[model samples]
Structures are given as structure tokens and as C-alpha cells.
Target: MPTAHAPGTTPITGVTIDAVLAGRLVRPLFQPIVDLSTRTVVGVEALARGPAGSALEFPDRLFAAAGAAGRLGELDMLCFERALEGAMAAPVAPPLLFANGEPAVMDQPLSPRLMELFASRPSFRAILEYTERALPSVPGSLLRLAGQIQLGGNGVALDDVGVDPMSLAFLPVLEPEVIKLDMSLLRDPHATHSRTVCAVVRGEARRTGALVIAEGIETEDDLVTAREMGAQWGQGWLFGRPGPLDGAGHRYDRAAAAAVRASRPGFHQPDGTPFEVASARAPRLPGTAEGIAAALDRVRHIAASDDAAVVVASTDDLPVSLYELAGQARSTIVLDRPVPGEFAVAVIGPGYGHAVCFRSTGGPELVMVDDLPTVAAVSRVLLNRHTRG
Candidate 1:
């Protein structure tokens, strides 16, 4: 008698998980997490794809095949090693690298592997994100291992929150440093259940001081809804699409990210005024006063001619001419001030003003227009709020 193939044991792809690990067929791609206020890249999540045109080319099937093949542990370790190697090899100083792992396998202490990865690059910060759909039967072991991970100077993030009841139970016990909101909840922020779950998660995050990142945002409305729901960080197509690390940090497109951040429909002014700016018109202006003046003049003349609802001005030094121009145009001015606002929304880059005073806020500030890409990317959002009373 030959032998019985395990049910669902048929390989989904021509390659086996063992072959993937041996051949190093798994490649790494990175998707960035944008700090909502700054619109700058804060972290990059490592995603695994198999060789081109392979059966495991996509992550879902790749992992599923591994599980069926009883090689989940091997595959997870390979992913961890590859992700760390790929991120470190990139030209830019690595941002926080988020590596995913299987919850069941992770029940064993990961300190050994983690310490090895960090041995050379001691300054590198790694956050192990758990993507398991269900809780381990003995969750205590996983919790203990999580504590060990922190002790080793690493952090843990619960990936895809609201996907299952088990994740809800893991929240406080695991005490994750970050909570990634599932994209499904964001697809319809108005859905009562989604709203309720968001509220619950937000409450937990506030209580725990864990940062919340809303993932899978596909539209501007999705971005707006994530912010309104109190997400401090966001990731999705609206920010930038995931791409291979390729050594040059190809995953991030600064100008493109800035444009999308600015064009989103609902930013607010200090007086609770709401306005809209066209992304096309919000060209990335130069950082200097002369550049600021010219961009302002151009926007002002055009807005006046079109009778547009908004004019955006972002400068390192608030020019009198720019203010005077706004006054002349009678358009509402959204100045990027150094002081805290009565109602200041979080924005990125140093030039955007208020955030500059706090160095700890970090990442890129809207300094020169280059930092954030364009005039529209800067101050327009600071002045636009939902229609107020």
C-alpha cells in the first residue's frame, strides 16, 4: 500500500513550502503606515510573496499551503529572516519593520531568533504582528512569550483587529503596543456594528496607550473616516500601494503620498470652518518666502477667477504678503501657526506649523513645501472642518 494523502494535502501550487524555504522563493514587499497627522511614513509592514507566477505568489494561499503541508513553522521562520534581511538591505535607514508570525508557532518564545536578528543592528526596532485567525488553545503560553518579546526590546502588534472574537480576548492580556484596525470596519464607518467595534477598540487603545492604525484604506473617504474614528495611523492604497523594497525604498512615494494626504476632502480651520482644495491645483510649492508668495499669487488669482472655495498657503516663515493676499482675496486663511490650536487637527511636516514645536512628534514635518510635496498638501487641511454650527 502506498500511503494516504492528508485531506486538502494537494499542493495549491507546483512548489512546496519546503522548496520555498530551501530555494528562498519567498520575496518581501513592504507597505507603509502613514501617521495620519503627518502624512509621513512611520513604519513599513513586511509582506511575503512567492516567486513570480508561482502557486504561492499571493500571501493568503502561500500561508494556507504551508499550513496544510505542516510546514507553517518553517515558513514563518523563513519569512522573519527574509523580512529582516530585506529591510536592512534597503538604502534608507530602516523605519520600524513590522514582521508577521503565526500565533500557534509563536507560543514558543521567539527571543532566540529575535536576539539573533537584532544582534548586529541593535538600533533596529521590530514589531512582530500576529495574523492568526483563532487563539491558541493555551493562550497563556502566547501571552508569556509576548512578555518575553518586550523584555528583549521588541514590541508586539495585534494584526487585523475585529476579525474574530479571539482577538478581542487577547487585547488586554497581550497588551499590544499597536492595534491594527481591520479594513472591513473602515469600508463602512457608518455601519452601526462597525462604529460600535471602533468605539470599543478606541476605548481599549486609549486605556492602554496603544497606537491605532487603520489598514486597507482604499479611498479618500476611507482615510477621512479612519481619522474621524480616532486612528492615529493609516495604511492603504490612498497612502501608497505596496511594492518590493528593492533597496531604494520604492515602497514610499513622498510626493504622491503628500498629494493624497492633502486632497482628502475634510480638514479643518481653527475657527471650525470647513473647506475643500483641489489636489490638481495644490502643486508642491517651494519652501522659501519667494516660492510661497508666487504660489499664493497663482492660487489666489486662479481661485478668484474660478470663484473657488479655498486657497492653501504653507510657509516656513508666514509672509505678510501672503496674509495680505489672502485678505485681498477675502479667502479664509489657514495659517500654519506655532501655537496649539483651540481645535488643531494633526498634520505632517514641519512647515505645517504647530507640530514643529514638539520634537518628540518626529518624522517629516511640513517645513519647506518639499517636505510635504505642495501648497495644497500643507495648510488647506489645517483650515477645513466639517460644516460647523
Candidate 2:
């Protein structure tokens, strides 16, 4: 077994990236995710470290070196394998193991060895956690990977949420089993931004029954604040630091455990246009293209001031205003589809969902949906098409 390194150890230089990957110098550390109500460890997040006393010991440096060498995917897979191996070797395995995955490599096929490792431990439950950093460029990829992970009887989590306002718009699209609040929210729970994030997260959790885990809880006060913010589970120094899995066992919270095991249904479908899928669930309102366009324009104006808003529109209509919306909204996607006299727009955010789909052939009628799930479905459909095109 590789010895775990303490922080601030003497840094050794000249460790080549090849040596690190070939030698498998990465070490796995487990930090417990405690059930705040029961104070029991429900899960452990796997953290990767580099060789002891080496400059690459820090994850940022290790990953940076790998990225610079154009081997980030390989390094990411290595870290994942090490984390699983460490968990399997532990004397008292956690009920849940949360592993970090880089979005850039999430679409790649899993290694045979890793697949076998997972098969070998059929009883072990793993939840793959990713961030929103890659959503704008690769929503389709992330959605596909998430579907694959859940289909394999594992779970998915959105990590470090609240750091990006746009993440709020993706809540329904991914439908993560666990939503890990970013550490910054806990550091200043009373901040206006923090409160807004908490309210949105709490509402989503209630609607979908997703488990909320607060990160960076180092004191009793932080724990209290986390509960008030509707976090059922938490991770940080107060529970345990990232280290070997020894002395980390605790009773499981049955309800929380069940929630972790119960995977939500997939949102993205293989077939159907954005309008076809979303309109099926929502009511189509009778209106002219001009009226629908006017309503969408109003939505665009409102979304411009909202930090969490995401706006997507077809370029056939409203070409100039789309540029202005792009500058003010958290995320803006302009789809270039030539359907004369057709107009479509979707605006979604934390607590809001609105979409306008107009078809000229159908006597200038349109489908308008305000339901969150339908709106998210519309956004996903458009995003998938954009990615494929």
C-alpha cells in the first residue's frame, strides 16, 4: 500500500509525468460525508493526492502537469481506479463512495480493469460527482455519461454547486441523486447570494427528493447552519479530514441510504424534436407568431437581470436581440436552423421555467410551457441537437 503524505511535507522536484502515471503515484484519501441529523457517516468522498514529499503531491499541481502533457484523461482514470481500489481494500467500507470525474473525459469508455473492479464488488455503491464547468460546451456528453452511470446501478452527483449560478438551471436536466453544496455557502451562510442559492437548492431537493450534502463544515455552528439550509448530509474537517479510511465507520441513516440507492428516471430521450418532446407535456397556447415573439422578448428582458437565467433561441427570428441576451444572461445558446417563419425560445433558471415554440405550418400556433421539467426537457433537446450539429 502507498503511504499517505501529510500536508506541507518537503516538496521534491523533477518528478516526471510519465513516472507518476507509470508508477501510479497517486494516493487515495477518504473524507466522510456525515448525516447531520444523526451524526453518522453516510458516505466518503474519495480525494486523490500525489507522491509523498513530491511537488506533485497536491492535486492541482498533479492535474495541471497532466493537462499540460495532454494526458489529463489518463491521469483522471488513474485517480478513479486508485480511489475504488482503496475503498475496496478498506476494512469497513462506506455505504456510499463518491468519486470525482472530469467532464472532459466523462464520455470516454470505462477501462476493462475498472469495469471488472466494479463487478468484483457488486455490493459497493459508487456515486460519480462532476461539476458544471463543462456543461455549456458538452451538455449532451455529460447527460449521456450520467445516463450510462445510472443505468449501471450507480448514482450521480453535482459537486461544488452554488459556485456557478448557471448550475441552478441544470438541476432538472441532470437530476442528481446527491447535490453537494460548495464550501463557500457554508463559510458565509447569511450572505444574500448564499441565501438565494440555499432557497433554490432546498426547493429542488424537495421537488425531487435529492439528498443535500453541505461541504466545509468545521464547527458546530457550521453544522447548525447547514441543517437550517436544508442539507441532510455534510462533509468537512469537523466530521473527518481526507485521509486513510481507518476509524471512519458509523451507523447508516436508513432513509438517507435509501434515497441514495433510488435513482431518478433519465430526462434525455433518444428521439424527438425539442418541440415534440416538450409540447407533449405542456399545453400549446393559441397565439400568432408575433404575439409569441413578443412574450419571448419580454422573457429575454427579465432573464437579462437574473444571475441564474439560461436563454436559448433559434437564430431564424430575433437574430440581433439574441446577441444582447447573450451578454447579460448567465448562458445563451443560439441555434442556427432555417425554418422560415418559425420561432422558438427557452428561458430557465433556479425557480423558473418558460418556453415558447412556434410553428408556422400550424396556423401560427405555439406551445408555451412553464413547468420546470418540461422546460428543462426543451432545453436539453435543443442542447443535444446543437452538440450533434
Candidate 3:
């Protein structure tokens, strides 16, 4: 793939990306995701390519151009539509279609053509796969979008797990129906990092019954390692490289596809203030400014760690510690106002959620919540406020 631009040259402009979109030049290829136990095709992941024989024929170059041109959302949606079109036209489509989604583009409304495709083929089910790379920056957005996708009877997947250590923490935040382990894990299953990933992934799978798929299986040994790591499905050159779907001779497994759809996490959009949301789930305890400060320190610790936490707090006065938290957190917002009766601080990170709220009518009595969903809800509420403001 060519660089976005040669050194000293101007950046790749939107004109190129715009032309590709206008011409519908994205080529969609399907790679089979197979059941390891039965060695049968359970689904296919759609891989996007650019126009044939073009400088952007490969995805890396294509997406780089899109990103440089500030048209990633448009390009992402186009690839999704093209993939759906290809699957729809295939003589024997796989039971399920896995589509890769960029977090920056995930919040965009579904394209009209895509919506039409969904309406036309009600039986067509998809599992939207999001990588962990950009998730920490926009987790609230993903949470909201994932809920919408699940509500529409689709499923969510976390792709390229184990590539980033922080991704392990986010397992609870995403609660993905399918977890795709990075190829490195299979290649080096005995490595300490790979072992940690396997343990966390196995625990998550057992807890939620999420299907695990291992990528990068080019050898029989890789397959054995994948199975040992608890992967139920496998994908890579071992099964088949990504290619036109019609030639794969894959038979649709309706039962397996239905199972994918049934895996939706049933997430709903959280409402109410942080305190109200958390207090509803857990009781409020009497506390002092000192206690609130201690809780904020805990939030600061998480923010400073590699957990990729987001911190939001409403306070009339900004403290040095709050500033430090903002400096360390993935994203932080300090609202300058009287703290709401419901909550003053909310921290949401991978596998963690916490909130501290002061009672509106009382003298410094507070509510501190540690419930995961409640913390997520509180974080959503705070983030929404920040977005809206």
C-alpha cells in the first residue's frame, strides 16, 4: 500500500475518497469463519477493498486516504453497504455476515441503502465487529450505538482482542456476543500475555456465553492452540482467504445464524441523572467531603492507570486533583456548577463503574454506587450532558 502521501507532498485530499464513494468502487470480499468442532462454515466476515488496480486497492491505503481526507465515516458506511450487497447477491450466502465497523463511524445513522437492504432481507442477520483500538476514546458512543444495534435484532462483536491489554478491561463494557482473538494469541499461546488473554476471554465467555473465534490459523498446530484457548470458531488462511463469496461453496446454516441473532445483549439506553440511576440500583450512604475526596482519588487512580477510564464530575470549584485526573484520563469533563443532587462524580472504565452523589436536601449525605450498569448509566448521562453542552 502507498503511503498517505510522500514526504513534503500535500495530504491525500477528499476528492479521491469522494470519487470512490460516488463510483461505488469498494470491492467487498468474504472470509469464512468456521466452527472448529464441526469444521463447517458458520459465518463470513466481510473485508473491504478499494477499486481494482488502483493505488488504494488495499484497505490500509483506502482507509488511510479516507482518514486523511476526513471522510472516514462516509467511506466506512459505503464499505458496509457494498458488503451487504455482495452477500445479498451471493448464490449461497453464509448463515451470518460479520461486518467491521470503525468506532468514529458507528454513531452515524444507518445509510438509507443499508436500511433498505435490511428491510428487503429480514432474514439477513449481521454481527457488527468493532476493534478495541479507538473504543476507549468513544466508549459512551459505542455503548449507545450497540444498544441500538441490539434493539434492531442484530449482534455486537469485539474484534482483535489481545492486541491491546486495556481491551481486557473493556470486555464488560462491551459485553460483546462474539469475541475475536487476535492472531498473535494463537501463534504464541504459551506467552504470558497470551495466557492472560486466554484466561480473561474464557472467563468472559463462560459468564456471558459469548462465542470465541480465533484468527490467524495457518497451521494444524494453530488450530490445536485455538481450541486449547477455548475458541469455538476459527478464521484465517487455514480455512480460506477472503475472496468472492460465490466460489466458496458455503451452505447457509439457518440454525447457527439464528443463534447469532439470539446472542444480542438486550441493552437499553440508560436514563436519569447519575445519582438517580445509581441510587435506584444501590442505597445511598451518608458521607462527608473527605469521603467524596477519597472516592475521587480512586477515580484518579483508575484514570491514571491503563484502564482507559473516562471521568466526569460536576463541582462548583475545580480542585488540583480534578485537573490531575483530567490530565491522566482518556477523557475528562469537569462541570463548573453546583453539583447535582444525584451525583458529583462518575467514572466509567473497562470492568468498572463508580459514582458519588450528594443528597440534594441533606447536609453532605452522599450516594456512592459501584454497580456496573448503574455506573455505565451514570457515565452515559454525564457524557450526554457534556456532548449536548
Q: Once model 2 is optimally superposed onto the true structure by TM-score, how far is the C-alpha of residue 32 displaced, in angstroms?
A: 0.6
Best by TM-score: 2
Those runs of model 3 whose alpha carbons end farther than 4 Å from true positions after fitting are: 1-16, 261-268, 301-320, 325-355, 359-365, 371-377, 380-389
Per-residue lDDT for 185-299 in model 2, tens only? 9888899989988998999888887889999999999999999988988988998788888655655554445657475446554456666766698766676656765767767
* Clash list (residue pairs), candidate 3: none
Candidate 2, after superposition: displacement of residue 332 in Å?
A: 1.4
In model 2, the clashing pairs are: none
Best by lDDT: 2
lDDT of 3 by residue, 1-389 (tens): 34443345454434477789889989999999888888788889999987665668679878998999899999999998999899889887777889999876666788898888777864567888989865656665677667767866778899999988667756765778899999988878899889988898898787677889999989888898899999998998988999999888886556677665274444535566656666787877666667767866766776777445666776643344567755466656555334445446776655566677665566546677777656656655655454222
TM-score per candidate: 0.58, 0.88, 0.84
Once model 2 is optimally superposed onto the true structure by TM-score, how far is the C-alpha of residue 102 displaced, in angstroms?
1.8
Native-referenced Cα lDDT, model 3? 0.75
Clashes per model (N, Cα, C within 3 A): 17, 0, 0
- Candidate 2: stretches off by over 4 Å: 1-13, 246-256, 314-321, 325-327, 335-343, 360-364
- Compared to the true structure, candidate 2 yields what TM-score? 0.88
Sorted on TM-score, highest at the top, how do the candidates line up? Answer: 2, 3, 1
